[model samples]
Target: MKKQILTTPDGESYPILTGTGLLETCGQEIAALTAPCRAMIVSDSNVAPLYLEKVVNSLKLAGFEVHTHVVSPGENSKSIAVFGALLESFAEAHLTRTDIAVALGGGVIGDLTGFAAGCYLRGIRFVQIPTTLLSAVDASVGGKTAINLQHGKNLAGMFHQPAAVYCDINTLKSLTPHELADGAAEAIKTGILGDPELFAIYETGDPENDAEEIISRAVAYKSKIVTEDPQEHGVRKLLNLGHTAAHAIELLSNFAISHGHAVAIGTAIVTRAAVKRGIMKNDEGTRIINTLKRNHLPTDSAFTAKELSKIATLDKKAAAKDITVIIPETIGRCRMEKIPISALEGLFADGLGEQV
Candidate 1:
C-alpha cells in the first residue's frame, strides 16, 4: 500500500492510504492511531450491503466493539435530521471520546458522520473509508465536513479531520462508468489548477490501468493545498475552481444534477467567461470542455443565467455584494475573480454555450 501523510498548517497530520485491498486493514490502521474501543461504522444502504460486514469484521479482529448504522443512500441523507439521528445512535452505542466513528461509504457518509463525530460529546475521533472515487480523491482527505441545508449545499459543516483515511482502489472497480466519470471532473479540476501533466492523464491515460496513480496524485495535490490552508482563509479558496456556479446549478435543479456534473458545467462556464475576457486562450477553454466531454461529463447547463444568478447569491463563496470565483488564467494556473452580484447573470449568460 502507498501512503501519503497530510499535515495541516497548524501542524496537525493524518495518513491517507491507497492501494488494492486496503479496506480489510482499516481496523489495524485505526487501532494504531487511537486505542482499541467501540467504533460506530456509519454507512448508507447502498454501501453497507457491499462492504460493511468486512469492515466490521476487521475492527472486531482488532479488538474493537463494532456497531453499524446504515442510512438510506443519496444526498437527502446528508441532512440535519439524519445527523441528529446518527448522534442518537452514537449515544445509544455508548461511543466515547476514545471510541472512533468510521465513515464507511461515499462523500455523503463521510460528511455526515464526520459532522456527528465533531458534535458528539463535544468531539470524538473519526476515520474515513471512502468507497466512491469522488470521495477518495476530494472529500475524504480534506477535513471539510458538512451537511446541506435548505439554503445551500454544505451550508453547515466543520473542519473535522479524520484520524486516517483508507482509499482502497479495489473498491473503485465496482463503480459504474458514470460514477467513475463523476470523479474525473474533480481530477480534471485538480489538473487545471496546478498540474498540466496530471491533466494530460485524462486525455491520454487509461483509467482502468491508471486508477491508483490518478487517485494518489489527486489526493496528493489536494493534501498539499489543504495543509497550506485548512480553513480556506486564503489559497484554499482556489480549490473551489468551478464550485461557485456548480453549487448554484445543483440547487436550481433541485439537485437533479450531481455535484460532479454540475462542476463540469461550471468549469466550462468559467473557462468560457475567461476566454471571452481574454484571460484564457480559446484553445485552453476548448481543451477543458473537450476533456470533460471525452469523460462523458456535461459542459453545459439548461438553467438560464438569471435563474443561476439568483441562486449564486446564496453560494457560501459569495460575500456581501460579490461572489469570489476561481478562473483559469491559463492551463495549470488560476486567479480569483470577485464579481459583483448584479453582473453574475451577464457572466453566466456570456459563458453559456451549446456544448451539451
Candidate 2:
C-alpha cells in the first residue's frame, strides 16, 4: 500500500491509502480512528449492493460491531430529506463518538457520510473508502462535505476532514465509461494546478483506470496539495483550479453535471479566457480541452452568460467585492485572484468558443 498522512488544523493525522486490494484491509486501517464502539458503513444503494458486504466483513474482522445503511443512488439524493433520514438512522444505532462511520462508495457517500459524521455527536470520526475515480482523486481527500440546495449544489456543508481515506484503484473497474471520464476531470485539474508530467499520463489517450502507478501518482499529487493547506485558507484555494465556473454550471444544470464533469467544463472555460489575457498559453488551455475530449468528458455545458453570472454571485467564495478564483498562469503554478464579476463574465465567454 502507498500511504500518505495529512495532519489537520487540530493536529489529527488523516491517512490516504492508495493501492489495489486495500478494501479488505480495513481492519488494520480503522484502528487509529476509534475504540471499536460501533461502525456504520454508509453508502448508496448501487454501491452497497456490490461492496458493502466486503466492507462490513472487514470491519467485523477488525473487531468492530458493524451496521450498514444504504441511500438511494444519484446526485439527487444529496439533500435535506435524505440527510435527515440518515441522521435518524444513526441515532437509532446509538452511535457514539468512539464509533466511526465509513463511507463506502464514491463522492456522494464521502460527502454525505462525512457531513453526517461531522454533525453527529458534535463531530465523530469517519473513514473514506472512495470507490470511483472522481472520489479517489478529489472529493474523498478534501474535507469539504455538502448537499445541494434548492438554489444550488453543495450550498449547505462544512469542512470536516476524515480520519482516513482508503483509495483502492481496483474499484474503478466497475465504473461506466462516463463515470471514468468524470474522475479524469480532476486528474486533469491536478495537472492544471501543477504537474504537467502527471497530466501527460492521459496523452496516450487511455482512460483513467486500475493502472497502479498512475493511481499512486495521482494520489501523491493531491496529497501534497492537501497537506500544504488542510484548510482552504491559502494555497488550498489553488486546488479549485476549474471549480469557479464549474459550480455555476452545476447550479444552472440543476445539479445535472457530476462534480468531475462540471470541473472539466470550468477548466476549459477559464483556461481559454486565461489564454486571452496572457495568463495562460493558448496551447496549454487547448491541451486541457483535448484531454477532456479524449476522456469523453465535457469541456462545455449549455448555459447563458446571464445565468452563469447569477450563480457566480451566490458562490460562497464571493464576498463583499470580489470572487476569488484559482487560475493557473501555467502548469505547475497557480495564483489566487480576486476578480470583479464583470471581468469574469468576459473571461468565461472566451472558453466557450472551444472545448478542452
Largest TM-score belongs to which candidate?
A: 1
Model 2 residue pairs with clashes? 289-356
Candidate 1 weakest lDDT stretch, 10 residues: 347-356
RMSD of 1: 1.8
lDDT (tens digit, per residue) of candidate 2 on 1-356: 67777776567677888887777887667865666668989989888878888888888888888888999988887899998888888899999878888899999889999999999889988889999888888888868898877876788889888888888777888889888888888887886677776677775544454355555667777767667777677788888887878888877777767778888888887777788778888887777778878878787669755667677878877787777877778766778898887666666766665322
Clashing pairs in 1: none
Q: lDDT by residue for model 1 over 1-356, one digit each (tens)?
A: 78999998778899999997777888888889887999999999888888998899999999999999999998998898999999999999999878999999888999999999999998998999999988987989889999999888999999999989998888888888888888889989999998887788887677657878888889988998898889998888988998878999889888889888898999999899889888999998899889899888999889887788889887887899887878898879999777798888887877885222
Question: What are the lDDT figures for the candidates, one per model?
Answer: 0.88, 0.80
TM-score of each: 0.97, 0.94
Sliding window of 10 residues with minimal summed lDDT for model 2:
205-214
